[model samples]
Target: MKVIIAIDSFKGSISSSEGGAAIAEGIKRVYPDAETVVLPLADGGEGTVEALVSGSSGQLRTASVTGPLGEPVDAIYGIMGDGETAVIEVAAACGLPLVSPERRNPTLTTTRGVGELILDAMERGCRSFVIGLGGSATNDAGIGMLQALGYRFVDDSGHEVGEGGGALARIAQIDASGTRPELTSCTFRVACDVDNPLYGPDGAAYIFAPQKGADAAMVEALDQGLRQYARAAEAHLGHDIAGIPGAGAAGGLGAALVGFLRAELLSGAELVLDSLGIEAQLADAQFVITGEGRLDGQTSRGKAPLGVARLASRHGLPVIALAGSVGSEASALNSQGVSALFPILSGPMTLEAAMDPKATAAHLQGTAEQLFRLIQATAGASS
Candidate 1:
């Protein structure tokens, strides 16, 4: 049998390649002569840089940049084998995890580091980019990133406004005269999964700010500031992007990418899968195996496993998924192309123990072995 496997990282434990390798070994134990094609997969969040970098034989580069709270942070990005495309995850510089729980205020955070990283990559001769936008710790409508890129957001007195979402409403002017001229020659592809508007009840401030540490009063204030920022950009930049799908992603960073950088926003998982050329891998495969750290209701909403399953299904392949744990809502995956779900845990164990790299690899291998035993028995019965 020719089996195709594409598994995402188990985050904090095994990486995508390690997990797929373990499962591939397990399959070998069952059918020693079987052909197994293993591929890396990710939903385009924390592991995006590692996934794309490793898969495409890219080199990683690190740079010091302003963090969410204005502190200097060392962020990592990748240059693909082509040496012209840079892959970046915005969260590496301004993600929620970088802030302490008590200090996790979106109003005070900034995405300046994202721009710094981009500028550094450009200086390195990378003109093509794939930026992953999620897990941000700001509600600033991307003014901070824009500032780093040479745009000026000034108050009525012509003084530049401060950083963070709190400074949005104080802006009265946006000057693009100083924008890096090199930007005109660059191309950006934004990996964004959310389609929220810039500001409103269902927009970034209301739906996502809460997780970024916005209280009711802060959410209201941030929402208003986002509106002001959008208005200023429309008036001064001549591009109106407040209502564009995904404009609210990463606290309106999507708006900056689209309105100013002319980026094409795409589904994060779809972007990763397409980058990996998954369709071609499925062409001659008889069965596909995919998995991630957790499988839940969110899986159907463009997560990596679902991305793999959907594509495999279209090619008349049955997809089986494995996870470290399965949520109560994981059953929803059945309707979205996953034929079955398998949890790799052998039995009860502590969270930390279950997350051990060696333990996870062993469990993945053992679970695959048992699962394929059933398949082997069924195939024999049919014969």
Candidate 2:
């Protein structure tokens, strides 16, 4: 029997690689000769870099970069096993986790560190960049990243505007003389799943700023600043970036990468599966086991587990979804190629207890054994 285990990180509980390993170990207990391949996946959010690095034989590199608040933070990016592609997660540098709750401020945050990482990879001869734009704490329309890449945003007085979205209101002329020429020779794949625009009632500021510590006033200010930034970018770049789908993601960092970097924006789950070559692995597998931290209506909205199910279905393989928490009409997952949705919590427990790494790991293993046992019973009865 052959089974492929592809699962996302359980968010604060287990790494995706570990989750796959636990499942594989369980499957082994029931069918020791079962061929299992583990591919840890990410949906372009936190831990994306680690997922990619762990699944592929990749080299990890770390550097000091400016954080969301201009503090020094250690950022990591990876060169994939193929040696030509670089995988970078913007969150590693400008993520919300770097700041305390009291210090979260979207208006003042920047993607400068992301740009620095990109530049660093470019210098190391990585030409193709897979950039995961999630978990950011900025709404600066990627101005900071642009600045790091040699684009200049000057204020009304022709002085270079400082970092942060708050500076977008300044009268500006953008100069792109400094953009790296190597960028033109490279391919940029932006991994994003959200479809929000950069400015509007449904845009970045209105939808995401509250989580970044914005008050009503800050949201309003940020909305206006994004408008200003959009106007400036449109005047100079001749593209309407604000209204583009996924442009508002990561505090408008998506728009910046798309408009300025000419990145091809794609669903994070799709991109990760493609990178890991899911289709090839699914070819002869009898069953495909996939999972994530939660499964609900959102699972149908392009999450990693859904991605895996869709691919598995195409190959006529049954898919089982294992999750930490299955909620609110999670039966809807069946429509997305999931045969059954399994919640790993064995008993009533606090969220903390349910998600405890050690406990969750053991539960996952046991769940796998149960699944294979059922599979074996059904096959025997049918025969």
The number of the candidate with the highest lDDT is: 1
The superposed Cα distance between candidate 1 and the true structure at residue 8, in angstroms, equals: 2.0
Q: For model 2, what is the error of residue 302's alpha carbon versus the real structure, in angstroms, after optimal superposition? A: 2.4
lDDT for each residue of candidate 2 in 89-150, tens digit (9 for 90 to 100): 98898988888999898878888999899888989888988899877888888989989888
Q: What TM-score does structure 1 among the candidates reach?
A: 0.92
What TM-score goes with each of the models?
0.92, 0.95
Q: Show the lowest summed lDDT stretch of 10 residues, model 2.
A: 45-54
Model 1 Cα lDDT, one tens digit per residue, 1-383: 98998999998999998999999999989999989988778777778888888877888999999999999999999887789999999999898888998999988899999999999999999999999999999999898899999999999999998999999999999999999999999999989988999999989899999999999999999999999998898998687899999999999899989999999999888898888788997898888999899988888777889999999989989999999999989999898899999899989999999999999999999998888889999999999
Pairs of colliding residues, candidate 1? none
**Candidate 1, residue 95: how far the Cα is off, in Å:** 1.4
